[model samples]
Target: MTDFETLGAFYLGKRYDMPSRARRDDYVLYDAKDLTTHAVIIGMTGSGKTGLGVGLLEEALIDKVPVIAVDPKGDLGNLALRFPALGASDFRPWVDPQQATNAGMTADQFAAQQADLWKNGLAGWGQDGARIQRYHDAADITIYTPGSTAGRPLSLLKAFDAPPAAVRDDAEALQERVNATTTSLLALLGIDADPISSREHILVANLLHHAWREGRSLDLAGLIGGIQSPPFTTVGVMPLDTVFPPKDRMTLAMQLNNLLAAPGFQTWMQGEPLDTATLLYDPNGKPRGSVISIAHLNDAERMFFMTLLLSDILAWVRTQPGTGSLRAILYIDELFGYMPPVTNPPSKVLLLTLLKQARAFGLGVVLATQNPVDLDYRGLSNTGTWFIGRLQTERDKMRVMEGLEGVSGGQPFDKGAMEQTIAGLGKRVFLLHSVHEPAPITFETRWTLSYLAGPMTREQIRSVTALAPAPAPTAALASAPALSTAATGGGFASLDARAAVAPVLPPDVPQYFLPPTRDGALLYNPVVLGLADVSFANAKLGVTEQRRVILMSSVDDGPIALEWDAAERVELEPSALEQRPHDGAAFGALPPVATKARNY
Candidate 1:
């Protein structure tokens, strides 16, 4: 019998109640206390990485841990729609997991178990009927008869407060001109308003925060006018109202932007809020559930939201009382465009730092990337847990293998077997390894939530909040805001600076850091840091008690007569004989780490 088994768990539309005969490919138990070190999930496209990431979070939230799922692809909004019906189903016949043997379980037994799980309403996981609202318009589409040729489009603009509709369809002119105009407008707007840039996000945030401060409502044009020039304007595309149709759609969007621009009406939210934890919790007396930044904005706007929140979240966390206790997790899916700009490596570095020590402060980060090459060697090495799934390329598999110390750093490395096994692993069965556990356990992720996550369409994203017209600037764009850290006022900017701080030493340095890595990879092997000297000749023949010097003792000890020789420097780990702290460690105990399981 396997030491770890769970046969009675329910699954999609079925249930199972095996009696402690759970197969090796079910799920691995992670002692929550051990999770403080943090984790990583790496796999190729369609390998169920996203599903697995959500599963862990589903469990964690039940465990009462706050979490942040960064959906650069804008899929996490489903969480808002993840209702109780998720995973709660009993409508189908029970069946055993794939290919159970008679001893494993007869078909009848499998059916019983399946029935049991489904009957318990522990069916699949997550909200089975979770919804992904493509666009606000899609959800609340109000049909408007072209009121007239001169002004129907213009009237629509008034509804959304879009710039007075300039394009006019002539009953006399060629139809081609009218069609071309509409096409140009849609193409320019990119059909949907997702993928916003870092700049645009801040603009929205800043506008809201600023308006919120003024205590008065200002519409889109009013806000845009405020940010018309230079730096702030350069961050993202300025023309948001074109899609909103100031005249055609509805005025509520325009009114809401101003209200959001105004501090009081805009949910009383201020600044960009992103971080592994706070995104999960409502801060400053706010609701802690979720913020569905409707994907109605353009790509630049969408990207802006991602970057601003990330930067802001880091800033917010710093405001928390202390280090070594951040308990938050970030779920990043389809993580590419949102990574640090291709020109900047620091962005990757910034994310890795967040992963390394999130545990101390009670933070956990999960990255689900389709492109395996994006996983960094240094970052992945620091993760406490790793879920690696199937891959298409030998090179990508090799990249993952490099994360294994035995294979990458010239220590009895086995590239072929590891690579072959990983490259061929079945779908949804991930190779799970973590700092707290040595053996690379394989399991099908516990299905805790319905898989409603899918790519977004351009039209679907535009329906949420439409862009508000920029307010014409009557005064210098608000003063450049100075961000103060938590020690002072608790704002998002301050938290970011602190989160971005890098460690000063390496993991094996024997220094006490929540996460051992400070900045770059440690250049030394740690095993030697605590070794005691055992040279027989160094025993001194017990002559030390008598204070007598032997001929051999002086061979190298005498400063006056011995000839000096130089030896080539071989890399050696620091040891107790030399590495002991002048002032000993406060705790005087080894750091928490998982023991290596000797066998697979």
Candidate 2:
């Protein structure tokens, strides 16, 4: 027989008899591909929920799958507690001394006992130190703490970046993203503004829509400026001033500006930006298990960060090729508040979008929660797999059953029978319900390779991730690839402060100045700009196409200057160019070689 623990098959555990309370010999191998349709884990406290979720992630990582887990409670950081030696010393630092005292043993003795218990638990589940090592070597686990430097900080600086062409081209997706972003931003400012009623919400939404539609990115500064002086003069046929006067607009701007100028707000702008590809893979292209711990963030911050992340993931998903096999997993540890039933939060919109569309692109979403009452079951009606663990109350069981029935999609479901099975479920026992399978089965979760040290402190988190790679500079990621200027000392030459006029170019070499978007004075620099209309025609293939491209390259007096090969392709129109610079704008001195038409 094929080994149940082989790649692509997650070895959850052996089957269990509920009525007889007997564990079966047959191992339950869950196919990783089944996750393409997504899954959910619903269990109450003390029901072994975290263990099962962590086990699933471990299996996925061992199979070379990348995971981006959002951990609100901080328990998932225990993924970093892998100790290949399985020694007492490895468990000493993390042992609970109170538990040791209760058990009538010294801390060292208790640690030794814990080590032995882990060894025996692994043996009982047919796992050993070798398998643990395999799990450790499979993927590098990193804990990321947003808005805090406890772990690797995750920056929201690039969160407002324009979506890729895929998302921008789809009107519904574009509007959905805009709505989520705007709502989340307002929420961070402690405004519970509704998209339909609140002028604040509508104006901010329109500002974002206008900028993003033009493929322009905005930081907090730019957004605040836009709020003060909107690009458009009207709001849905009404005059802008009448809708929101300049005084009111300035008030709104000040609020946002105060947030931007806050003492600790800079932390939100530091560290790595939210890039889905980087989060899913390491620099060497290996799969990674990235755990984003949000336990330190407030409710508003969590909603805002999650909304941005989901929006980015949605954009990333649209750029990926469609596939039936699972490409990656997005696991949200607690989904209660993010996706409530009656009220729609910014996170909910993106979550629903992902659940409906991400499956086609091989992105599986796993949502887990201990609170069943707050979930939006109607939104999760299509979830393909569910791991139902021991419930706390009859009400919780009823809510889960209703969700399960909705997921059944007209298939026969025996609520009473399932309830009995759930009632018979003991700790660590779960009912695995999957649409791909004919019927639900009961199974016990296998031993976890990593030690469950509970919610880790900031100090513990830092210790665990001390060896992980340092985060790359955000500037390096934001900037486009450019030629090395090492020979020129990697910086611009000293400028002529006396020069106040724009450099005159040959008639054949057209020059157009860019209009400034901000209120500050502008500075002009000479560059070699070219526009071309290229065409490709093939008679046999019956293909004919024409495209407009604009290339811009800096002019320098260096030996390898004016290289069109190193020019950046700019998405701009010739009409937007100005024939003259704005009044009072400063001019940067042109290089001596920039005036030559031959250089172009």
* Model 1 agreement with the true structure over 15-77: per-residue lDDT tens digits: 111233233433355555545566666777778776666556544554445556555555554
Model 2 Cα lDDT, one tens digit per residue, 158-236: 7888899888888888999999999999999999989888899999999888988999876676676577657799999
| Most accurate candidate by lDDT | 2
| Candidate 1, position 539, lDDT | 57
For each candidate, what TM-score against the reference? 0.43, 0.80
RMSD values for the candidates in order, in angstroms, are 31.8, 13.3
Considering summed lDDT, which 10 consecutive residues are worst modelled in model 1? 151-160
Q: Record all residue pairs in model 2 with backbone atoms less than 3 Å apart, i.e. clashing.
A: none
